[model samples]
Target: MRYIISYVSTVNPDLSNTDIAKLMDHVNVHNNTIGLTGILIYSEGNFFQVLEGEEEIVKRMFERIKKDSRHYNIIKMLDKEMNDHSFSEYHSSFTVISDHYSQTELQEFLNKEKDYNPEHYKSILYLTQKFMKLL
Candidate 1:
């Protein structure tokens, strides 16, 4: 079965651009090796990432992520088995959405129940598009 594992974290103050690049490289290698797909969103000092892959592979990746030193305050926002992979194109994609959402939008997102947050995903997608425009 496919699974979706999402997490939120903050980058460590000591992390450097080189460190971030290396970590991304490591993630890319692992994702390619295991056929994983995902997107990572960073905004306002927080990061939200969603990983989709075989249940075992995704879980293993999450375990490694938990021990990674690039970030802290890690929280598993969502981890559930799914019937299909939602994102199948990229091994992983990165976005910076420092201005994607307003305060009201963020509040509405946070108030949503776990199972009723399609809008939140939509917002993330919108942010990704915005980030892409800057590329």
Candidate 2:
């Protein structure tokens, strides 16, 4: 079965912008190599991410994520088996919502995703808005 997990986490205060960029680079490369697809948004010291892939692989990745020291206060908003992969449009993606304009653009892009589950889409939008408001 395929699985999806979405979560928001507080970034480690000690990390610099360069560190975050390196982290995003690693994520994109590793996820592509492992055949996972998802989107990640970071803003205002928080990260909102959705990862989808094989059930066991996704679960294992989440476990590893829980152990990563770059972030804390992790709150998983969604996790379940999924019959469809809504984020396959990209192998893996990352973005930083720095301002209202970026947030609006991202929201518009997400809204245009026809394959995304409405419930999941709404949940993501809520989390994104929450993070953006903190910026």
Candidate 3:
């Protein structure tokens, strides 16, 4: 079985682009090394991320995330075990929604995956929408 976790949080406003880039690099390397896959989206001052991998590792990573000083107001949107990882093809993805076009692209990408798992997709889409609304 695979474990998946999705959450939204506010990033530290003081973080510069360079800081965020470095953070993303660390996340990618760490997650890939642990055999995890998922997507992370940031916009305005908010962050939305989904992580899928081994149950223990994902849960451990989430705990570390909760303690990370760079963000706050962590609100978990989803946490459960599933038969497969919906985003196994991607090692780890990070996107910044800077404008309506980027947001639209993200929506389209999620829309295209609607058939993968309706329940999961619905929840993921809803979380993204909710995260976007924070912008």
Candidate 4:
């Protein structure tokens, strides 16, 4: 009964990187205690998070996330049960898709989870691609 929920949200402009790091630190500890794993990508005031774990726990966490005051306009791009977690090793990976990931870096990120269901990530990938083009 594993689930992966991917969503994007508009982050509060006043929040700084240090604030995000502190938040992720707390989230990582809490997620680990509940056996959840995922990555969080934030760039240009947008947050894309992929959360995976037991169905009920994941759903509960998502519900809390939706109610959090830190972000708003959350759009869930994918939500489905899966046999395995794509982000097994990372509790809460944070990435900023900036100029630092131009050549081999960005490709490295995309190549890691090629076996996962592409349909589940099509919208996020499309947005990432478009963002890359602008850089």
TM-score of each: 0.65, 0.75, 0.74, 0.74
- In the range 82-119, model 1's lDDT, one tens digit per residue, is 66555543333344423333322333333342245564
Winner on lDDT between 1 and 2 is 2
Error of 1 at 78 (Å): 1.1
lDDT of 2 by residue, 72-123 (tens): 9999977887776656522222345454554544555456432455666676
Off by over 4 Å in 2: 89-123, 131-135
Better of 1 and 3 by TM-score: 3
Residues 17-118 of candidate 3: C-alpha lDDT, one tens digit per residue: 788878877887878788887767666677788788899999999999999989999988778876665564323334444555545545554764475557
Write down the lDDT that model 1 would get.
Answer: 0.61
lDDT of 1 at 45: 52
Best by TM-score: 2
Q: 92, model 4: CA deviation in Å?
A: 3.3
Q: Please report how far candidate 4 places residue 123 from its true position, in Å.
A: 1.2
- CA-lDDT, candidates in order: 0.61, 0.72, 0.72, 0.69
Where's the lowest-lDDT run of ten residues in candidate 3? 88-97
Which ten residues in a row are the worst by lDDT in model 4?
97-106
Q: Give model 2's TM-score versus the native structure.
A: 0.75
